[model samples]
Target: MIEILDPAQLPRARAVGALVATILQTAKARCQVGTNLLDIDAWTRSMIEDAGAESCYVDYAPSFGRGPFGHYICTSVNDAVLHGLPHDYAVVDGDLVTLDLAVSLDGVVADSAVSFVVGQGRPEDTAMITATREALAAGIAAARPGARVGDLSHAIGTVLRAAGYPVNTEFGGHGVGSTMHQDPHVPNDGRPGRGFKLRPGLLLALEPWVMADTATLVTDADGWTLRSATGARTAHSEHTVAITRDGAEVLTLPPAA
Candidate 1:
């Protein structure tokens, strides 16, 4: 369902967004060569409880995934890109990690994701991560009252394609508000001047993800994690944005220290 949040709910949205961003940043900071994926999940759980927020992923059960995600955060390493269910795995140096988080606070929900390398990053991986981040920015920049969903998608695609990465539309961004996923599926690539028209009070989670060499994806044995078909490294970047009278306001930015 498409939900246009009221001004009264905007503050709740911002609060949840801040929580998600803060948790992601904290998880990223603790990622080390010997860090365990389970530990990250535990840390996320604690933070969510301490903040009096609800994890959108812990009980998530979608058609594409196995029932009940049973994890607090999505820990994607290397080729693993989307829906990365946390498992028993130790992070190694130079491992590319993507942390996707969503939470509900005061009845509002926010979602965001970030991709980064653990230790010394590889040139290609760094470039791919930069490309997703740039695409996400482009998408947000295109978001404003009266803008069409295609406009945002096109802007995101232009950046990813230019960076020589294949775009995958199977899993992309979506509208977010009281729930984690809502209407207006925002693909990573699309033709401009099409799809849903942006309006004030609308909230969209614009994510731009890409596989280094191929667009195809293969599910892992766990039936949750999605990895590059060619075993190529991947990256994803996302943020929850609110359509405002002036422009798009990013709700999921990390809180300033």
Candidate 2:
């Protein structure tokens, strides 16, 4: 179901967004060449508790996932891309890690993700990161009020395709608000003017994820995890946003130090 937040509800959404941004930034910064995946998850738990916010993933059990997420955050390293459950492993130098997070503040939800290389990494990894960011920005630019969801998807595809990367449609953005995942599943590629229409008060998470060379995706041994079809590198970036009369507002910006 799609949810449109009244203007009054936007303040809460912004607060929730801030929390997500803060948590993600904090987690990403602490993640290093030798950081442990379990430690990252624990740190996420601490930050959420400190903020008095609830984890959108802790008990989340979508049809695609195994029962309850049972983790504080998603720590996807190297080949692992989406729904990467935090595990008992330490990140080594050159590992490309993606931290995806979603949380709720006063019942409002905010979701975001960031992909970065650990310990200086490889040239290819750096390039993949830049491409994903460009794709994400393109998608957001096409997300103003009155633009079709397909317009956003197509914009994302155009950027990725031009960058010489393949798009993944199995997963993309989705309606977000009081709930982590909601209506109008935004695919990475589609015909412009197709799918749902955009309007003020609508909240959506526009995520663009791509692997270095393949369009296909493979599920990892863990039922919830998704990886690139090719054994190549990957990157993903996302943000939670609120649709406004003028345009969409990106709610999850890191707090000013």
Clashing pairs in 2: none
What is the clash count for each candidate, in the order shown?
0, 0
lDDT of 2 at 222: 76
> How do the residues 99-208 of candidate 2 rate in per-residue lDDT, one tens digit apiece?
99999989899999999988877888888888888888888888988899999999989988888988879799999988899998999877899989999989999888
For candidate 1, the clash count comes to 0
**Candidate-wise lDDT, in order:** 0.93, 0.89
Quick one: RMSD of model 1?
A: 0.7
Q: Candidate 2 versus the native: TM-score? A: 0.97
Query: Which candidate comes out best when scored by TM-score?
Result: 1
lDDT of 1 by residue, 1-257 (tens): 99998888888888888899999999989989999999999999999999999999988999998768889899999999998988889999899999999999998899999999998888999899999999999999999999999999999999999999888888899999888999999999999999999999999999999888999999988889999999999999999999999999999998788
Native-referenced Cα lDDT, model 2: 0.89
